[model samples]
Target: MATILSLSNVNKNFGALTVSDDVTFDMPEGQALGIIGPNGAGKSTLFNLIGGTLAVSSGTVQFAKQDVTRVPAAERCRMGIARSFQIPHPFVGMSVYENLLVASSFGNSGHHDAKAECRDILDRTGLLPKANRPAGSLTLLERKRLELARALASGPKLLLLDEIAGGLTEAECHELVETIKGIRDSGVSIIWIEHIVHALTAVVERLIVIDFGKIVAEGEPSKVMADPLVQEIYMGISVDDTAA
Candidate 1:
């Protein structure tokens, strides 16, 4: 498959702290890839680097065969990259529909009938019923839905989901997972960073385990999860030790 996004020896530093250490990976076109690791392992940092919110310290980022390491976030969005935050903070004062309109207008240049497209996105994300509701009035799940809707309105080819399922009920998470599956089925590539392994596994074709800003493992979800190194990162002990 052709690569949609590629990071070559990407690195990010905040003074003495190196958040991304020569991170390199490729996201195949139309693939949903899951990222898993302990907290502070540079998961979000990688997203930032990919989405153009943060520049790489010493590497290249390519999107659709174009070098975008120096691209601005807005330009990248217009170039088909969009992301949701771990904690959604949508336009609180605006209605949900309005939020989508804003995103579509900005991120989807030359899109005709953005309103119709936004409506479709609202329906797809299960946010149609609340489209007229103020964003600030939404519950956690609703906010997350709105976040996904807004990203869709941006017309993304690659969607970056950053812990969007962090605070949902089991039922709520399942609903979101189904919605995400629909998105993946619709051919939107996804890079989901989530602690909820089941949710990621349900929607992603592959899994990558990151530690200290580098990919520790990458493969099919089950095999990657079962790797002793991945188990130690998650369980804090070798599987042999745990069994013994």
Candidate 2:
């Protein structure tokens, strides 16, 4: 598979504080990658760099084999990169379908059939019944689905999801896991940063564990989670935790 996204020796800093330290990775087309780390581990910062919301202090970001380190966020969106925020920030006043239409127009360069495309996204995200409801009126689970739907409306080849499954009941997370699996099956590459291990493992082919802005472990989900360092640092578990 060809690489759809690549980060080489990436670094980010805020004043004297270093947030990302020479982070690097490559994501192949149509692959699903899960990222797990402790809070304040710069996981969201990594997403910001890839999504063009933050400028890298050093290193490069390449997408679809093109250098996009200096590309503006909107241009990156037009270039087929779309992301959902850890916090769902939908347009409260806009209907669910209307919000998707806005994303479709912005990300697809005013595609003529934006409404049709949004309808499809709503269906895919299991929000068709709430399509006409005000976005703010939806429950937390519904809002999360809308966030995913809005990103999908952009027709992205690479999707960056920031904790889309956070704050959900077990049953709701399971439902989201199935939806995400369908998305991966449809051939869109994904990088999901999530704390919910079961949800991430259910949808991703590989797992990467980050600590203090560095990749400490990466491989198949089960193996990565089982690593002594990862289990100790990120999961805060000992071998006995598994045995128990």
Tell me each candidate's TM-score: 0.93, 0.93
Ten-residue stretch with the least lDDT total in model 2: 235-244
lDDT of 1 by residue, 154-201 (tens): 989999999998778899889889989988898989999998898889
Please write out the lDDT profile of model 2 over residues 1-244, one tens digit for every residue.
9999999999999999888989989989999999998888899999999999999999999999999999999999999999998888999999999998877888844467787878888987889999999998998778888989999998899999999888888988888888889889999899999988889998998998888898888999999988988878864533434566
Q: Could you tell me the C-alpha RMSD of candidate 2 in Å? A: 3.1
User: What is the clash tally of candidate 1?
Assistant: 0
TM-score of 1: 0.93
Candidate 2 residue pairs in clash (backbone atoms < 3 Å)? none
